[model samples]
Each structure stands twice: as structure tokens, then as C-alpha cells.
Target: MSGLGFETRQVHAGAIVDAEAGARVTPIYQSAGYVFDSFDDGVERFAGRSARRAYSRNDNPTNVVAARRIADLEGGVDGVLVASGQAAIAMALSALAQAGDHILTTDRLYEGTREMIRGALRRQGLEFEALPIDADEDAWVAAVRPSTRAIYAESIANPLGEVVDLALLGRVSARTGVPLVVDNTVATPYLCRPVEHGAAVVIHSTSKWLGGHGSVIGGAIVDGGGFDWTAAAARFPHLHEPRPHGAPSFAERFGAAAYSAYLRSVVVLEHGPTVPPSSTFLLLHGIETLSLRMERHVANAVAVADALQDHPAVARVHYPGRADGQAERVARLLPDGAGSIVSIDLAGGRDAARTFLDGLRLVSQMTHIGDVRTLAIHTGSTIHGKLDDAERAGLGITEGLVRISVGIELVDDIVADLEQALDAVLAAGERTATRRSAAAQLEAVHP
Candidate 1:
């Protein structure tokens, strides 16, 4: 399979033989529980001594299919399917850190993730420090305190469309003995597998690209199985310590399986952040077409960004693929295209941004990205709206910023709609400014 291509793996990796039904496609085992042959069998299942299933919360056939498929796609040892992308983040972080532990994160994280780190976890006594994604490598090394548990960042940040330097961050992880967790939702495994580049953990929001059609709300955390928890024993007591029932130290018992095994048997099972088997099924289906869809998505996005850069109402376009103004981080990390998301700073600020959004004829204004039809969102008013003025500013989410996720739609039609929208906003802005100036002049003369 290592010699096989991604498209081939996406189509063929996780289909298991149906012993009872003779089904080619993985059947949806929508049941809440599974039965054992005898009382001793149940004990064997609960003890993690058997491969058989015990409860839906622990594992399910449908969920296993999804997890296996995702693991193959991302080159991970195993993956845990969770309720949503946020759940994946919560479970993954909680698995690594406890109360009084600290997490070092990039400030340019997705809005909900930042909220989860700074807002929700802070109240629970867990601490986090935010640093610029493009900060000096030494700055990252210096930020690691004795209590620092993990370093987290997105593969390609939302709205900003900045690609992170995985190898450099990997160096930080190696030096500091802290695992690097990355949210690969934007890039998906189709474009990039962070694990291949030294990420200890790769998390995803299947609601965006992995589910492809935006039909399912799901997420996954893939374990690279390379981080040695015992080496950082003092920092991560949860992984290093022996279990209550003499269940063995996770680092000793599982070794490479430490992160994922803990995530499933401990956090996911106990906290109940399980994805419905039906949702997992949807995600698996979407993954089958992931490679093909991502190619079109990137191509369409490049065309859209190029066209938007030329529009009068577009002040700037932020797509890492552009030649002259490209972020050097992108070339180092994203050798493939920068992904489908394009963030543009519209010329006329908030009001003009709204006009451009309203004038768009074909692109739907939606909260979700990575769909078949083009979608547009104004970050300050929609996705990042939860952040107050100061927070938004800190995150570089300006009032005029419009985030567009290009789909498989015809590049020509998409550009035409954008052109019209931009033209309308600029025309309206010029007229309004002129009218206001004329009105002030007339009032002064009459007075």
C-alpha cells in the first residue's frame, strides 16, 4: 500500500468482508449495543482482551470503518471518530493535558478552537499561550514552560489561509519533548498528511472537506504513534502513570499506541464524545472521493484568488499559491496547492463588504466550507463574529475580510459573479462618498 497512490487508498482501504450478510459495502450497524455469546465473553470484551465490540460508546462496526479509512488516508496508526471537529479538539487536548497543564498554540487558530482553548479550558484551570504562527523558531522554544504539555496549530489556518511550517514545528517538538498536534481540516489528507512531516497528532473537522458534501458533522484525531510519552513523564503524568486497576502505564503498555488508545478507551468512552455510526458512514463515503474533489477544489481556488486580486473592490487576496507575495512558510509546508480557502480583504471595509456579499449571484453565503458549490463568508460578521473588536483585531480578522471557499464550479462562472459583485460595491461606494461630501458642502454654504 505504501507504493499505491492516495486515490487508490481512498477507494480501497476500509471495506471489510461481511461474514453474515455478504455485503461489499460496509453495512451501517446502527445499533446501540452488541451481544456476546456468554457471560465470560462480556468480561473479555470489557477487559480490552478481545477484538469484539462491547458498547457503542467504545466502538462500533461503522465507526471502525471510518476510523480505519481515515487512518489509512492520513498515514496514522489509528484514528478516533468523534461527534464534531470541536469534540476532536476537546478530547485530543484533554487526553494530553490536565488541570494546571499549559498548551502553546498559534494565535491564528480557527475561531471555535481559540474559544475552546482560551475560554472553556481556562475556566477549567488549564492554561494556554498564543503565539504568532510565523514567529521566530527560538521564540517557540523559549515559550515552553515546565508545565507545557503540547504545541497545537492548524495545517492551514482559517480565513488567513497561512500554511504552518511543520518541519520547524517538528524541530520544536523534538527539542522540547512536547507533541505537536495539528488541525488538518483545511488541507485534508488529500493535500497533506501532517504525520508524514512529523506531527504527533492530526485532527480534522469532517464537516468541511472529509465529509465533502457538508452533509455530516464529524471529526477525527489520528495518532502518528511516534511521540514517546515516557520521555516527557514529568510533563504528562496521565500517560506516564499506572492505571487504577493496575492497567499498566499507557506509555509502557501501548508505546506508539499511547495517544490514540487513551483517546478512545479513556477520553472518548468516558466523556462520551462519540460520533454516530450514521455520521461516520457519511464521512467514509465522502472520503472515497476526497482526492478527486481536492484537486478540483485547489484549481478552482487558484483561479478565484487570481480573479479577485484584480477586482477593484478587493484590496488584497491571501492565497499561499500566489508567486510574489507568497508566505515562505507555505512553500516549506504546503508543497501541494494552498488548499481551497481564499481570504480577501475587500476595499470598502464593513459596509462595502456587505454590499459585495449581497451582490454575489451564484456563491451562497454559508458558514461551512468545502462543498460542491462555491461559498462565501465575511469573517468579521460571521465566522469570527463571536470575537469582540479587540480579539478580532488580534486575530487579524478585519471588518473588510471576506473568506471564500472555492468549489468544483466552473472557474469562468465563479469569476464572472465575483467581478459583478466587486464592480457593484465599488460603484456604490464612490457614489455614497461623493453624496456625503456634497451634502456637507451645501450645508456649510446655506448656513
Candidate 2:
């Protein structure tokens, strides 16, 4: 698998040839539990002493194939699949830090992830401190405390497409002795491998590009197997502590895959947020063509971004790899492409956004990204709607901002659809301006 190309690995890395039925394609092992050989076998399985699985709550053959495939792609020693992207993040963090622990993060992250940090995770007693993405290396090291468990950030942020400097964060992680946990969802392994850039654990919303189609919802947590648990043993007592059943600690037993083993056997098994094997079957099919779909996805994205840049209705385009402050980083980190999310800020604000959305014909108005179909959404009114004006503004979710998840459609067709929408927005804005001016003149004349 290590010597194999990504295209080959995506298809064959974790596939199992069915021994009983001789099935080639991985079958969905949809049963709730595996049949135990005997009472002793069941006991051993439950005790984590057997390679055989006891239940589908944490271990299913189909799901395991998908997990290992994803891990192989991300250059990780092990991987765990959960029900959703949110569940993946929750389980990954839970495995590292518990109540009263702290995690440091780069400020620019997906809104959903940020929400979890500030909301649910905070309420659960885990504290997160965010540093500016551009903060100096010393600043990052200084931010880490004795209780700091991890450094988290997205390889490329959502909607805005802001690329984080992973090397800097990785260096900071090395200095602070905290593992770097990166959400590589937006910049799927097809575009960037964060583990190569010093990430200790990589996270992904396989519901996105990895699953390619918007069919199944799943998430994966991958352990890079690079972080030293023994050196940082004092901070992570659970990994260093012996099991309740008098078994060796996770670090002692699992070696390089200690975090992955802990996450799967401890957090995921206890929480029961297992992704259905049926969904994993669909996910496996999606992953088979990830590289192909991503190539078209990125090509269409760059085309759309280029087309929208000087459009009269667009105030700014949020695509990366352009002539901007992030150009250098984008070139270095995302040389393949800046991903498919191309967000635009409309000059006409909220009303124009409405007209634009209403006028769309080809692109679907929806709340998803990395779909085969191009999807569009107004960020301020949807994903960030719960926050006030100040909060939205702080996160760069403007009144008229539209997030476009560029699909694998023909570049010309995608641009044509977007152009029509922008034109409608501009026309609507002009009409409103004319009406306001006419009313003002009428009032002045009457006075």
C-alpha cells in the first residue's frame, strides 16, 4: 500500500476478499454483532484480546475497510470512522483531553468546528484558546500550558478558503510537546497531505470530497503515529494508565497506533456513534474515484473564481491561490489546487443575495459542500445566523456573502450559471437604487 499510487490505494488498500461467499467488492456487513465461536471467544472479543469483533457499535468489517482506506490515504497508522464530521471531532478531542483540559487552535477554522469549540465542548468543561493563523512561532509555543492537549486547525478553512500555515503549527506542536490535530476536510488528501507537513492526527469529513457524492455522511480520524506519548505521559494519564481489566496502557499495547486504538476502543465504543456499514459501502464507492473527481472539482473551481473576480455584482472573491496575502502559502501548501469552495461577497448585500439565489437554475441552493452537484448558500443567513451582527462580522460572514461549492461540472456551464445569478443580483440592486432616488426626488419636490 505504501508503494502504491493514490489511485490504486483508494480502490484496493483496505478491501477484503470475502472468504465465505468469494465476493470481490467489499460487502456491507450489516449485522449488529459478529457470531462468536464460543463463550470464551465472546469474552476475549469483549475484552479486546481477540482480533475478531464483538459488535457493530464500534467495529464492522465494511466500516473498518473504509476507515483503513482513509487512514492509508492520509498517511496515518490507523483511522476511526464515526457517524458524522462533528462526531469525529468530538471523539478525537475526547480521546486526547477530558474535563479541565485545554486545546490551542488557529483562529481561522470552519464555522461548525468553531461553534463546537465555543459551545458544546466549552460547556463540557474543555477550554480552547485560539491564536491568529499568522501568529509567530514563539506566540504559539507561549500559548501552550501544562494542561494543553492538542493544537487544532483546518488545512484550508470553509467558505473563505483561507489556507493555514501547517508547517508553523507543526513546528509549534514540536516545541510545545502538543500533538497537532488538523481537519483536512476542505483540502482533501487528494490536494494536501497534512501528515507530511507535521500533523500528528488528521481529521476529515468524508461526507465531503472523500465520499465525493453527497450520499452518505461519515467522518474519519487518522493517527499519524508520530507524536510521542511516553514523553508527554504526565499530561495524558489515560494513555499511560493501566486498563481497568489489568491490561497494559494503550501506549504500551498499541505502540505507534496508541491514539487510534484509544479513540476506537475507548471513545467511539463508549459513545456508540458508529457509521452504518451501508453508508460506508457508499463511502467506499465514492472514495474509489476521489482523485478523478477532485481534479475536475479544482479545475472548475479555479475557472469559476477567475470568472467571478471582475464581475460587477461581486465585491470580492474568496478563492485562494490568487494574487493575495495568502498566495505564497497557498502555492506551498496547496500547489495542487485551493479546493472547490469559492465564496463571493456581493456588492448589494442581503437583498441581492436573495435575488441571486432565486435566479439560479443549474446550481442547487443547498447547505452542503464537496458534492457532485454545485451547491450555493448564503453564509450569514444560514450557517452563521445564530450569531449577532458583531459575531458574524468577526467571522467574515457578511450580509451578501455566497458560498459556492464548485462541482465537477463543465467549467463553462458552472461559470454561465453563476454569471446569470450575478447579473440578476446586479439588476435587482440597480432597480432598488433607482426607486430610492425617485422617491427622494419626489419628497424634495413636494417639500
Q: TM-score of every model? A: 0.96, 0.98
Candidate 1 per-residue lDDT, tens place, 351-438, comes to 9889989999999987888887889998898778887899888877888998888989888999899889989998998899999999
Q: Worst lDDT window (10 residues) for model 2? A: 315-324
Best-fitting candidate, measured by lDDT? 2
Tell me the tens digit of each residue's lDDT in model 2 across 21-140: 999999989899879999999999988899999999989999999999999998988899999999999999999999999999988888898899989999999999999888989999
Clashing pairs in 2: none
Local distance difference test values of all predictions, in order: 0.86, 0.92
Q: In terms of TM-score, which candidate is strongest? A: 2
Q: On a 0 to 100 scale, what is the lDDT of residue 21 in model 1? A: 82
Clashing pairs in 1: none
TM-score of 1: 0.96
